[model samples]
Target: MSHSIAIIGASGYTGAELIRLLATHPSFEIKALAANSKAGQSLGAVFPHLRHLDLPDLVTWEEIDFDAIDLCFCALPHKTSQEVISKLPKTVKIVDLSADFRLRDPEDYRKWYGNAHGATEMQEEAVYGLTEFYREAIAEARLVAGTGCNAATGQYILRPLIERDLIDLDEIILDLQCGVSGAGRSLKENLLHAELSEGTNAYAVGGTHRHLGEFDQEFSALAGRPVEIQFTPHLGPFNRGILATAYVRGEAEAVLEALQQAYAEEPFVVVLPMGETPSTHHVRGSNFVHIGVVADRRPGRVIVVAALDNLCKGSSGQALQNANLMLGVDETAGLMLAPCFP
Candidate 1:
């Protein structure tokens, strides 16, 4: 029952996370690890925390034998992922953790990423990797595109409301606070310890954040019309989770009822009791989502909030969930670990 696996961009945060989770997977075997720049280095040298695991030394993608691999996870940067993935053998199934294939249309890709897509044909075949809603499509597809962490957080709170016709499409506003890790493992002056600690600031204000494209595509499709929402994202001082609060015009009782119904059978999504909200601390390091709904003092105003690990459920964990479906294995395998708490 072992499914051979390989990981490109194995030196990145999402790549490290995939390795961490797969270490305990009963049916997945890590056959190869690729990180071009870090090629010839042991995975331990790249990530000391994983130094204890017996894994392959890093190698360039070209050195790996695709014939021996069942599936591959690509954790490269946006434009780079499409370029590398396009050259990979079609025989290998792929789970891409990049912004490259999330937007199905080539035009939308250009609008958000500011570059023409390198692989439009493959984009057409890739399924959006929101395991809860696109479960069936993912099971049958060869490539699955992981959503933006911000996008996934917002959707978890808003999708059901939109699907059940319970909210005003034009009046949705999502305010999110994301841990510094969501920005990736890359180095930047703004992310320095002195500059980022003990403070919070909002970035991508006024609807310019790229994840809005996902919100537009997904919500519009569910509503059968054009739907646009105001989204503002903030950078928090911590290092692991995302807390997204959505403001919408709807009846609290109905909104809560719809969310409960939508996730009633979903293993990873938890709908809290009415008037009860969730905290990022409760869902950190796990592939679980906690959602809460509350009625505002002003009637007809409803606030829905959701929390989850950006690196886990928001990206790598989500990729693994879809990979299990694509591989015909149990959907929850290796992913039911309880959230890490204080």
Candidate 2:
């Protein structure tokens, strides 16, 4: 009853994450790993932490016999994801961990990502992969597009509030701090330990963060108008987790009730008691998202916070969740492992 799986772009952090999570999954088999740059190299050579597993040796995408795979996790970079996924066979389902297909409109994709979408034909069918809101669509989708890690954290706090009219959509502000892993396993001068450690600075200020495209799309769709929240993301001095603090205009009690009611049945989302905000460390290394809400000293104002491992709940964890639904397996499979705490 096990399903064969392939990970395209398996040399990246997210690819290794998928391997770690699926290692314990009862129904998924890691059949192939495609990382052209590291092709023919064993996984251990690229990621020593994963050296203990008996996983497939790294290979180029063209080398994989796609027919043997039932699902493919496209962890490729944004511009390249659509191009690679376009060639995948119809028999295989895909969970793409990139910004390529998250935006439904080709124009929006180009605007945010600075390139024309390569797989325009697939846009209409690629479901947005925020599992909680798009569960039904993802369950039947052949392709699911994963949301940005920062975007996911913000939505976990804002979506239900928007839906219930519990907050002023136009007045929302999100200040997020995320670990380096969200930048992927690429070599960049800024990500260097000496340069990045012991310091925190904001990037994608104003309405410029690409994930805003997702927020504008989903929140606007929910509110039936363009809802643009003030979002600012910071590179935290850590290896994992994202903590997003949002300021909003609403009754604290109502916002709390709405969030609790929305996620009361959700397995991964935890709504903390009023006045208690979540820290990134609380949910580190797990597929859990901790959300908290509190009233500000000013009336009609509230503060909301959310935390999760950028690599886990925000990315691969979500991809795996959607894959489970697409494959008709238990949604929580391979995702139930508890958070790694001190």
How high is each candidate's TM-score? 0.99, 0.99
Clashing pairs in 2: none
Off by over 4 Å in 1: none
Write down the lDDT that model 2 would get.
0.93
Kindly report the root-mean-square deviation of model 1 from the true structure over all alpha carbons.
0.6
Compose the digit string of candidate 2's lDDT tens values, residues 93-165.
9999999889999999999999898889898789999999999999999999999999999999999999999
Span of ten consecutive residues with least summed lDDT in model 2 = 116-125
The lDDT values for all models are 0.96, 0.93
The all-Cα superposition gives candidate 2 an RMSD in Å to the true structure of: 0.7
Residue by residue across 1-342, what tens digits does model 1's lDDT show? 999999999999999999999999999999999999999999999999999999999999999999999999999999999999999998999999999999999999999999999899999999999999999999999999999999999999999999999999999989999999999888999999999999999998998899999999999999999999999999999999999999999999999999999999999999999999999999999999999999999999999999999999999999999999999999999899899879
For residue 160, give model 2's deviation from the true position in Å. 0.4
